[model samples]
Target: MRLYAIGDIHGQLDKLLEAHDRIQTEAGHDAVIAHVGDLIDRGPDSRGVVEHLMRGRDAGRNWIVVRGNHDRFLPAFLERPDWIDPGLSSGQHWIDHPGLGAAQTLASYGVDPGLDREALLREVRRAVPPDHARFLATLPLWHLHPLALVVHAGIRPGVGLLDQAEQDLVWIRQGFLDSDADFGPLVVHGHTALDSAAHHGNRLNLDGGAGYGRPLCAAVIEPRGAHLLTGKGRVPLVPEMTG
Candidate 1:
């Protein structure tokens, strides 16, 4: 079967649909698609994007969606847990650090990160149905294979993949990936998008903030192999914010 992996969708429903069509055409038949998460809360059509994914999964579309930091926020919101939505305002989840980076990002963009949690709840509810929430909840933290371990961000160096906490798996960036160390497993991640997939000895970051209009891209990886797929440019990024 053709095993295909795409990077974070970030609610770019049109680009996602385009990417799917392109993948289908390239494969010349149906194939498995493993998504690296961050499916909602940015761009437009967050609801539509997730619903499409649910339909695909329900139809036995051999898919794996590893949980992303953005995806992680919903449960906390749903359960009224301690953590707040860190990835707000900038329109990117993992990048919007609630403690430090979020403030700077909002100031830079002249927007308020303090959009009420209650309002956010209502927006999410309007966009996402119960089935979609269940779908998001059901996603795995990582997809491990002998060849590669796919994660929304990346696993912490020296940490066992299975033992990795959700936050580290979804939100961690440079400190985790830039470790002058190896993670033992070749980690394929999509959280910290770069201009191109950064190829360390074992870490592959396949997100360049495509939802930001840079380019919704992914790296197709196999043992002794890798390639980039730039999906159709339907994902609109506020030009100012990207700068």
Candidate 2:
């Protein structure tokens, strides 16, 4: 199967659609498109994103999404939440996970570390509907396929995959990106979208930070390596619609 891995599509629905259309046309046949998460939060149409993915909830549709740290942080606030002001980037995880490193981890795609994080955090949570919330809540921290091991962020250095911690898989980065560690399989990631899918042996990054108005990226990966997919347009990134 020709696999396509997508980077972050924060809410650029139009770009996502364009990317999808391109995938259908370019890939053809039965190409699987997988997302590395952070589907909402920055751009607009967070709801639209959720709806689009939710519609693909049946068999035959080759779509898989893993939850990024951004996706999980808000929900962590909701689940094991500490009373955030419904306004700031103030959270236990945000505070606790201090070693996360380099604000612009996904810099290749114009992920501004300067984005009003507090506001962004608040807005992102408010936009997620119950259905999407449930979906987010249930998302797997990692995706293991025959040819790929997909995770929102990357995995730890020395820890075995089965023995790796969930927090590291979903939130940690420095240890994953800095070390010469090799995951058993080719790990395709989305959290740290550096330049061109930084690959060191067994790990690849595809997150283009679509939420930050860069481009929604996807990759076509097989045992032979991976291919890239990107789309254009803004998707009318407005603020606060419904859920």
Candidate 3:
């Protein structure tokens, strides 16, 4: 089976549609598409991105979406607009960081994050419907296939796939990114943005920094190996050895 794992969308609905088109034209209906989270924020049309995925899932399309750190923020912020987890991002509130891009997300829903706290909460609550809230809230942390593991971020080193911490799965960096430990199967992930999709022997980083005005990318993975589904065509993904 061909598994097409998409990189962080970051609210780029047009790119998401383009990626889907590539998959449909190249791989056809039998292939599975795993959206590697961060579906919203930074770019335009966060709401549209969510609705598009939801529509696909509702139509029984083979789509899997994992949660990203930015994904978690929207639901968290909706519940407590002023909430901030100091442990994550050095106490930066979701809306406070331009990188997190919650303001853009709010803009997608026709709400303003700049309004005073009470009014902001009210406007956001009214703008975001419950179904959308539930959609974001209930997303899985990871999707495991026999040939690959799909996660928003790299997994914790030395931990069993089932034993990885939730935070590490969506927010981890140094320990997982720097390690060269074999993770059994190829770990397909996003979170750390890059110029393009890359492989590091143990894993693949597909995020092309779409939130930063870069193109979104997806990889077609099979038991034998993997290749990125680029605009030009398939580009082979060759994993590099790391320490």
Candidate 4:
């Protein structure tokens, strides 16, 4: 089966939609689409993004969404408004990064962000659809395929897939990014942003900084390797490579 891996969306619903359109056109109806999470925060339409994906899954589309650091914030904040420990919920640190875009998310649900914390919490709890919360709660930390290992962030350099920590799968950087160690399966991931898809010998970084005002990307992977799905069309991950 053909596999299409989408990079970090981070609430850029427009970009997400555009990327999916391209995927559908290029990968055909039977392709499995894997999302590298971070579906919320840092953009204008987190709610829309979640809802769109939910609708697609409900329609029997083959879609998989992995858990992301920003995605965890919603549940944590919903469970406990004070769950803000800079490292935990983005809500606690929203002030430091207004780009968390919580207000836009609230706005999407018709809840006023100006309400008191408790009142806003109540409104948000009441406003957000239960299915959306369930969707976020049920996301897997990683998706493993024979040809590709997909995760939100990168994996721990030397850890076996079964033994890898969830934290590292969704949040790691240095060790995974800097290491050139073979990861068995070709790693397809999106936590670290880049100008475009970057292909290391062992892994491919697909995050094009969608939430940071760049295009959302989808990498089409075959047994041979991967290609970036662009507006013009599919392009090889490594331009110089030839089959």
TM-score of each: 0.75, 0.72, 0.96, 0.91
> In angstroms, how far off is 31's CA in candidate 2?
2.3
| Candidate number of the best TM-score | 3
TM value for model 2: 0.72
lDDT of 4 by residue, 1-243 (tens): 578989999889999988888888876766799998899887888999999999988899988889987787777667767766444344445423476667776787788888988798898899988888888978999998877888999899777888988788888887888887778888888888888888886888888998889889888888777889988988888722211
Candidate 3 Cα misplacement greater than 4 A, ranges: none
lDDT of 2: 0.63
lDDT of 2 by residue, 1-243 (tens): 666777877666787777778877876735677788876555555557767877875445678888876665445554554533221245434423443322322221234445565654454445445676788778878878888888887788777778888778766767676655546777778776554444455677776655555666656665565656544421221112211
Give the Å error, residue 158, model 4: 1.9
lDDT tens digits, residue span 1-243, model 1: 234677888777788887787767666335666788888655565667777888887787867788877665555545553455554445544324443232322222233446565654555455445776677777888887666788898777777666777778778875776565656766777887676455566666668676676666644555555566555422222112111
C-alpha RMSD of each candidate structure in angstroms: 7.7, 10.3, 1.2, 3.2
1 or 3: which has the higher TM-score? Answer: 3
lDDT of each: 0.64, 0.63, 0.89, 0.82
Using alpha carbons, what is the TM-score of model 1? 0.75
Best by lDDT: 3
The positional error of residue 203 in candidate 3, measured at the CA in angstroms, is 0.2
- Which segments of model 2 are wrong by more than 4 Å? 80-128, 230-243
- Candidates 3 and 4 compared: the better one by TM-score is 3
Q: For model 2, which pairs clash?
A: 3-220, 4-219, 5-218, 5-219, 6-218, 7-217, 10-211, 127-243
Task: Please list the residue runs of candidate 1 whose C-alpha ends up more than 4 Å from where it truly belongs after superposition.
Answer: 81-127, 230-243
